[model samples]
Target: MKNLRDEFPLIAKNKFAYLDSSATSQQPKCVLKAVDDYYKKSHANPHRGTYCLSVEATNAYDFSRQKVADFLNAHFEEIVFTKNATEALNLVAFSYGSFLKKGDHVLLSLMEHHSMIVPWQRACKTHGATLDYIKLNNNFELDLDDFEKQLRKKPKIVGISSVSNVLGTKNNVKQIIEMAHSVGAKVLVDISQSIAHEKFDVEKMDADFVVFSGHKMYAPMGVGVLFAKEELLEAMPPFLLGGDMIEYVYEQETTFAPLPQKFEAGTQNVGGAVGLKTAINFLEEIGFDKIKEIETELTKYARAELKKLKFVECYFTSNAKNHENVISFNLKGIHPHDVASILDSKGVFVRAGNHCAQPLLRSLGLNSTCRLSLSLYNTKQDIDKLVEALKYAYEMFFKTK
Candidate 1:
């Protein structure tokens, strides 16, 4: 497990404990090398040229797509690459969302990230469709009763995150998908936070659409995955036009490319695709069970230690086992940014403020929070350092006052 930290070059060079893996993970050496090597040897505009370089680039990109497809138990054509998860969500919100009619409803939980929330909000607003949220219970978890009630409204589609970005609260996504389907609703599950911790089988999950970001799962930025059922992809129109996404173009009419290419409008990120492939290979080498073990242990230990801090108020569910990688807390009277700054001075890094989930925080009666997220590479010592730095921040604040 100690060897995992060494695999990430940036982690190796930095003495600080990088507890912000949820924002974006540090790239492993293999992923970086794969990206660098692809640019040096195989960079080309795929699907646009007949040259050998372009052919090689095309093969690499296709292979990466196939790899991701296999990883998700999805069809190769069902896998569309986007700039990031935000774009992938936007694609869905723009494309399939176009089918929405007046009075059609879209349901999401209160815990959704802004990427998931804003897109649906825009889509519903555009289509004269109603958008509403499932309420959260006292446990800081999504209320199943509220979810069922929302389903009663016959939402046309439902968007949900498998894990909360701020709270690390894992939802019963499989059950939700099943229920949503029974209501004749399509379901989109954002696995951006959960993908790094476990293996995924989209078919088994019965999800209509799934999205994730490469950067969240140890690959470089600029690559994201959108896995929709082939039927869904076929039914939805393309979100963007131009470049490789088109099959034919005339002065007055144009036909779009099929499957995955239809959503990928521009020159795709071949280098990032190369890196994403290597990142998957690297993670498989480490194995998901080991990754979960490391993160789960750290989470439990940190929860126990944090519980001892009276001045620190945690903003998560009471069930310690309910949360996974993210630990949202704040010094009782200090601003989150100030706490972050103090922690930074002591070589402990974390995310401050609303974590792009302002609505979720407001729902929790918090304006902001300091969030420390865990990764497989994180150790108990890292948690210890965070604890020390937090104590330092608390003391520095009240003692000075």
Candidate 2:
């Protein structure tokens, strides 16, 4: 634990219990230095410049793309870097919508981030298509019976999250993909929450598009990934048009660049890509499976401890054997915001809100809940402080009465 704590110097100095890794992860020194090194040694526009520094920078960025591909076990040609997961989902929604005709349907799950929902909503509006929702059962799992009913509507696209950011429920993505494929719907998975914990192979999942954010996986902001099938990339039109994405621009006609670059218009995030590469390397060195194991144990402990508090009304299942590294719950007769305020006083940090899944929160009949999300960097001591803080919060907010 000391070694792990020593690896993250800021965690010790700040003394801040950071359980909000779902929003963003703390970058290690290696990842921080990678961004700085790029600025000092290789700062040039990628793929366009012919100078030595330019070529070096281009190779570094391209290599980063390959690293991302390898990380997800997909082809380099299939990975398209975007500003964030929101932009990635928009790329698919807009480009794919261009081919959609009026009255076409797009099916989405109730357990989606706003990024996954809003873009498709706009896409359906723009193309005069219809958007339908697959229902969720009492336990917050996707209702297959309801999904089968919606399949009859002949949806052109099916969008879902691999893991719920609020509920911490891991969806049956492989089965979801197979079912959607049987109905001839292209499946898009929002892997922003799952990628950091589990191994994901696009081929095995059979996803048409898989999107995730770098910030969630110990990388810096302003960079994310959108992986698509090769034929689909070739078929869909570019969402944005600019310098790097075009082959030639004339008064009459223009040809777009191939596969990835066609989608990534403009100069691109060169330094962010370098940082992302470093971040991925960090995860690989630590071993994602090991990270998962540590977090799984901690999450289980936290959930079990939380359930024991008389004031806590757990929203998600306490059976930590099933959930991911997230736990959301409410204190009896106390608002979630107040609970967060008390925890804040004790140097504990947790999210208290719908967590960008407002629709799902509403479905759960909750405006908000205190969320404790774990990462590989988190330890038992962090959870101990949180549990202690929760006990204090309950006593102050409810037990006093």
lDDT of each: 0.92, 0.88
Candidate 2: segments with Cα more than 4 A from true spot: 399-401
RMSD of 2: 1.5
Best by TM-score: 1
In order of appearance, the predictions have TM-scores of: 0.99, 0.96
Residue pairs of candidate 1 with colliding backbone atoms:
none
Q: Model 1, range 1-401, lDDT digits (tens) per residue?
A: 44888999999888999999999999999999999899999988999889999999999999999989988999999999998999999999999999999999999999999999999999999999999999899988999998998899999999999999999898989999999999999999999999999787998998999999999999999999999999999999999888988889999999988888888888889899888989999888988888888888989998899989999998778887678899899899999999999999999999998999988988888898999999988889999999999999999999977
lDDT of 2 by residue, 1-401 (tens): 33655665577578879999998878888888899999999999988888999999999999999999998888988999999899999999999878888999999999899999999999999899999999888876778899999999989999999888988888889998998999899999999998888879998788999999998987889999999999999999999898899998999999988878999899999899999999889878878777888888888887778878787888675345558988888888888899999999999999998899888888888899999899888888898898899889888866566
lDDT over C-alpha atoms for residue 377 of model 1: 81
Worst window of 10 by summed lDDT in candidate 1: 315-324
Instruction: Identify the candidate with maximal lDDT.
Output: 1
Each candidate's number of clashing pairs is 0, 0
